[model samples]
Target: MPNSLSARTWVIAATGLAPLTWGSTYAVTTEFLPPDRPLFTGLVRALPAGLVLLGIARTLPRGQWWWRSAVLGLLNIGAFFPLLFFAAYRLPGGVAAVLNAGAPLFAAVFALVLLAERVSARTLLAGFAGVLGVALVVLRGDAHLDLLGVLAGAAGTASMSAGTVMTKRWGRPPCTSVLTMSGWQLTAGGVFLLPVALLVEGAPPALDGRAITGYLYLALVNTALAYWLWLRGIGRLPATSVSFLGLLSPLSATLIGWVALGQALTPLQIAGMVVAFGSTIVGQAVAGRRSPVRSVPVAARGGTGVTNEPVNGR
Candidate 1:
């Protein structure tokens, strides 16, 4: 039991690297990457990473998985990435972050309906707390909300929420590693974005040293490694619990802005951070209690196995 608990804790922390790293994306995109080329940016973030992972894994989707991978990719990355970038471009950073913080609520609903997972009151409360906390930390009263950006944010959140539940439902192909699965999704998403980016944004922007460094960081560490960890977490933890970890993205972004960009952190923002982080803790604890700890098999731990569905049977 102790081992099981420890293993779960480790997985949770490792999985968290996804959102935590993602927090830096706003800074990177604004500072280093080309300006106003969201689709192209999304393309760079996903495609190269996908190709690299596919090469390393030496695996392709087989049978129904060919289409399944495409669908999941469209929802999670293809749609989510473009929309996320679009929203970021159209909206204030704080507004965009607050909109994204609503993802846990979307995940909770999707889990109940699609995955047949029961929603607990505590989890629901925690979800609300997460939203409020993020609002406090990042949202500014003077921030203007663009209608299109708001819609994009909502759509992106819903798209990824559905994807998260579906990923939990479909699990991965038998005997496939998380690396291969991530490759399939990332490649599909990149492919989907290709024509759209070209048509909407014209040719790619000129790359400088800073741009290259930013893309490399985003592709290798942010997208590839982070997504591998996230999908693995979805396979191990409850969908809603995994979604709750997304709160860290906004928190990470706000802190980065304050520390790296020299933006001021008001006392209210600090309190909001406490609230958001506290809610994440409560949500995870509630989820863990609901999901009784059991020993994870050796195969699941190795990242090469079937039956890598959520441990709570979500």
Candidate 2:
């Protein structure tokens, strides 16, 4: 077994990778997938990938877990995915990303409402800063805004934020693994999309080799693998801390836009990135400071009886 320090380090690294992989979605969708049918693309990206993960896990959720999983899936994946794709297809990538940055702010509100979690001044400030950054990025030099796209993105972010808070509120059942929890959500989301995909998209498009590859990467790696890691991190870390880390998603998307897609960033966009990322870091730091410290029990370190440093100061 890895030591506590090593394990924590791995979790952070894995967390970072998840968002970075997510950042690639814009370029992948634009470059590879057939265009114009946003809902269809969302269906393909979610349902197939979800089924594969469910097969691998081979653990069906039981009792209350089923309902909980379904709710979470709808909010986090089913609704969020389709709306996100709609916004992405309709709006500029920078604008979409900026709108999605409202996730943290939504999360804060939902956390207070659902989980009764207190929001500190620091977190609130950070949330505002993040929103400002997003506005800066989206507004940029353009005078006109895509109202439909903005609404879609904001709705998607709200759905995801509610889901995140619900997950934290519900916590995980002792009998279920994070993989199983994730599988349930994916399966539910996929099932929800099946009819829509069939009706709206009709038959699957004739995919070229590159498109096929992109779909595979998105389904297997981005949805299944990344989601699994994310759930695990949520189990281990503070809810606010984990939510704050999501600010990186937009930042990563910005960088990926610049590097992979050869999209040029205006000065406003750069400023937005700094403010958004900086606020996230500050929020997490403040949240961490307020949380109580718990000593690491030696037995958790594989029974060596040598206590390791507390993970996340708890």
Candidate 3:
């Protein structure tokens, strides 16, 4: 068996996969999913995936978690999804992802205010590099980056940033696993979105076999599995550090664009990828090693341990 530290490394790596997989959202939405149905798509992705996870876990939220689930579900899933899909549809693939890369900056500020965590100078540098790198990788003179898309992306980032910090602060119920927490939020978000989707979209669009396959991929792999791992990591890692992993989404999207869509990466984009990747590593490395759970172990180098670390304190 692996030692504690080594095991934590694997967990962190696993956490990284969630966003990396999410990076393909733009291409997936444009090519595979029904267009102009952001709300419907969002509903399907969140509701069913959540139900599946809930069915497997068979765990329910108790007491205050009912509202907590609502709040988290709205921010992390409901609002974020519509805004994200709106941006994805309006902007070029790179543009939306580039806007999302702003999440770490927002997360850092939220951590400082809400959790009292300090943003280090190195991390600031990392943020700067990350932004610059994303700009280089995605911003193109010819791409029509819409104002509405930019706003939607910014809103999505802010929504998710707040949700992420809040999740880290509150932690999950003592008996709850990440899957249960994710299920609660997903279910709540889906519920919130259902009426909105029905009201705005008229009805869920018809789907053929290809669309069904796409929705299944999104529900099972992208939303359900992704959120479970992400929530798990949030409870175990510094919220700000976890936010930094989001930069990988754009990079992953870029690669998918290149391979699947036959989009070409310029030399500048390749250089930017290096800087973005490097900055993400440095930010996480300098952000310290542990998350702050309330009742976790002292030596449980694994992120699963509960901690008393200040929301803003080391």
Pick by TM-score: which candidate is best?
Answer: 1
Q: Per-residue alpha-carbon lDDT of model 2 for 125-172, expressed as tens digits?
A: 898898787666655455445889889989998998888778766666
Model 2: worst 10 consecutive residues (lDDT sum):
301-310
User: Over 4 Å off in model 2, which ranges?
Assistant: 1-10, 292-314
Displacement of residue 261 (Cα, Å) in model 2 is 2.5
- Put down candidate 1 lDDT per residue, 171-262, tens digits, no spaces: 77567888999999999999999999999999898899999999999999999999999999988888898999999999998899999999
How far residue 55's Cα lies from its native spot in candidate 2, in Å, is 1.9
TM-score-wise, the better of 1 and 3 is 1
Checking candidate 1 for backbone clashes, the offending pairs are: none
lDDT: worst 10-residue window of model 1: 295-304
What are the per-model C-alpha RMSD values against the true structure? Answer: 3.0, 5.2, 3.7
lDDT for predicted candidate 2 compared with the true structure: 0.73
lDDT of 3 by residue, 1-314 (tens): 13545555665688899999898776887888877887888898899999998999999888888898899999999999888878877887467777788888899999889777788888888987898898889888876868999899899989999999998767776657788889999999999999989998997788988889888888999899899889877876778888889888889988999999998989999999999999889877776544322345423332334543323333
lDDT of each: 0.87, 0.73, 0.82
The candidate maximizing lDDT is: 1
Give the local distance difference test score of model 3: 0.82
Which residue segments of model 3 deviate by more than 4 Å?
A: 1-4, 90-93, 143-148, 289-314
lDDT of 3 at 50: 94
Alpha carbon lDDT at 294, candidate 1: 52
Clashes of 3: 6
